[model samples]
Target: MSTREEILFELGITPRWKLRDVAEIESSEETSSSEDLHKGAISSNASGDWSELKTTIESCDRCKLCESRKKVVVGVGDPAANWLFIGEGPGAEEDERGEPFVGRAGQLLDNMLLAMRLNRRENVYIANVVKCRPPGNRNPEPDEVDACSSFLDQQIDLIAPQVIVLLGKVAAHRVIGGDGTLASYRGVEHRYKNISTVVTYHPAYLLRNQLDKAKAWKDLCFAMDLMDKKIEQRK
Candidate 1:
């Protein structure tokens, strides 16, 4: 069996299905070369310097979230990563640590990255839709998201990842700009700023709904497939 089939078997997804053709993605008019998008994103931002961006995020008071947050989770991992993972927002632990996904959910995410043969220290970068933690880990308000959206956009432009994986409904909604349910977005190809994108359950959600782990694995497999094809195209 092929690697894809093996992964499907291990994940308990019977009768392995074929991934969507890379050609379809290539043919899409919305698709642009990753290099072009990267350049476009950098140019669009007034100050593309990483340090300056972090400083801006640090001093940002566009929303009331800054008042309650202990530290702004600026994001962590390789500055020039190929895989960008975007989560909803920071939780308590993340707020305290000033990093994204450093709690129990973060541990699971690390395992997920290992499964994909990637890691935080390698070709992977992680960030959140909202940098500050909600008062009580609640969903970030729309106004708060609007306040922080440009920073996230700057991060995406700077990283220029080959594929973007949206971790939950909020990220899916924020990046992909849709009101659709998470279920509707999963197992399908999406795009953000002309880059290939995938959606999957958040590790925190998977922790609560253990049964969905298999589905999440499938989503990872799909993302891996997309990454492979993108890499192949670059060759």
Candidate 2:
């Protein structure tokens, strides 16, 4: 049996090739090597504070994306959530809707969350490394991530989640700040802002590579186990 088949067996989810074929996400990246940057001054905000962070993001002009964004997706779900899902940035649909992980990718994510018996509307908080959507949905520029790092840091500090599941390589790099490959980062528990962290394929990537859903499922299980251990340790 193939890895994908094995995972489907383990999860008890039926495999439908036609459905899988229909779910492939088209590449949203534009063919532009131009690094046209917006030269806006970045301002420092109060650390360990939520209001200040939200205000800064709403009015941020530190990166080029701020100029083109329809809305800055700070986050959604419970502020005091024990689980936080962090992604790279907003996509076209997310940008338009002013919410992260909306549309198909979001739907897949919702399914994933459902599979784990967790709901985004409940004890799960979702946010991205960069609040603003990059033009054409490209990877967030390093400077953009840097400018927004403070906000993400503040959010982590504020939420104080037991486990953070990073949703892509970009998120792994932004949170962990290392040169390690995503494969190397997976299955190992890392720390971000002193909170336990796990790395996984982004839902968008999983949409394109359905076989990896099993691995991503493993990562989610790892995160849940870690959170359970933490809760037990608190007793």
Candidate 3:
């Protein structure tokens, strides 16, 4: 009957999706944020003019958000990783740290990956849809996500992660298709260029909401399962 439960119902997924602990997420926010980030999104597979793509995003001005950006967070992960994770964009801490998921959020993300036995140096990759952090850590405007679309697509083609985990609303909307509300979506498999995608709350959200850790744990388990299955398939 809570917001998290409401989201699970909307997604029509049982088990992990129904984590009714709204208070945990409510408490988890450093200040509620979003991406054009992805499951620690990777750019290894991008196609169509890497040179042009780099030039394009490097000088992007399609959205007002571009003017205030510190750096365009393209992505960081093993180019050969078979799994991809995406979130929205950088936060103030991320902007300052210049590393994806480095602050409190990043530390939690590292824990999430640890739950799945994924090491940042291996087995996974990370990125945001829009590299720059929006002013005041606001939701990325659609126009901003659009400007960065080329890089995202290329990253997909380049990395070719068989399994992709969408970490937050911005990443969810980009990789799957939704308004990016955990209150309305999670626990279902969405598709991106024919790859399997799972949605979950952002690490920052988890940090604020300790009670939902178990539910988030379920998501972590599922992700590990999918990755394991994919790894087996390569055999």
Top of the candidates by lDDT: 1
Evaluate residue 118 in candidate 3 and report its C-alpha lDDT on the 0 to 100 scale: 59
Q: Per-residue error at 21 for model 2, in Å?
A: 25
User: Following a full C-alpha superposition, what root-mean-square deviation does model 1 have from the true structure?
Assistant: 7.6
TM-score of each: 0.81, 0.79, 0.74
lDDT of each: 0.79, 0.75, 0.67
Tens digits of per-residue lDDT, candidate 1, 201-234, equal 9989977886786788779778877776766565
CA deviation > 4 Å runs, candidate 2: 1-49
Residue 207 in model 2: lDDT: 82
Q: Spell out the clash pairs found in candidate 2.
A: none
Q: Residues 1-235, candidate 3, lDDT per residue (tens digit)?
A: 2344444333233554433233443343333321101233333343355466656666767777778877766667776666788889988877766567888888667666643445576757787878788999888989888877777888777778878888877788887775646746676666789887788888878777766666666675566556545545644
Say which candidate scores most in TM-score: 1
Model 1 alpha-carbon drift over 4 Å, by segment: 1-48
Name the candidate, 1 or 3, with the larger lDDT value.
1
TM-score-better candidate, 1 vs 3: 1
Give the range where candidate 1 is weakest over 10 consecutive residues by summed lDDT: 37-46
RMSD of each: 7.6, 13.3, 10.4
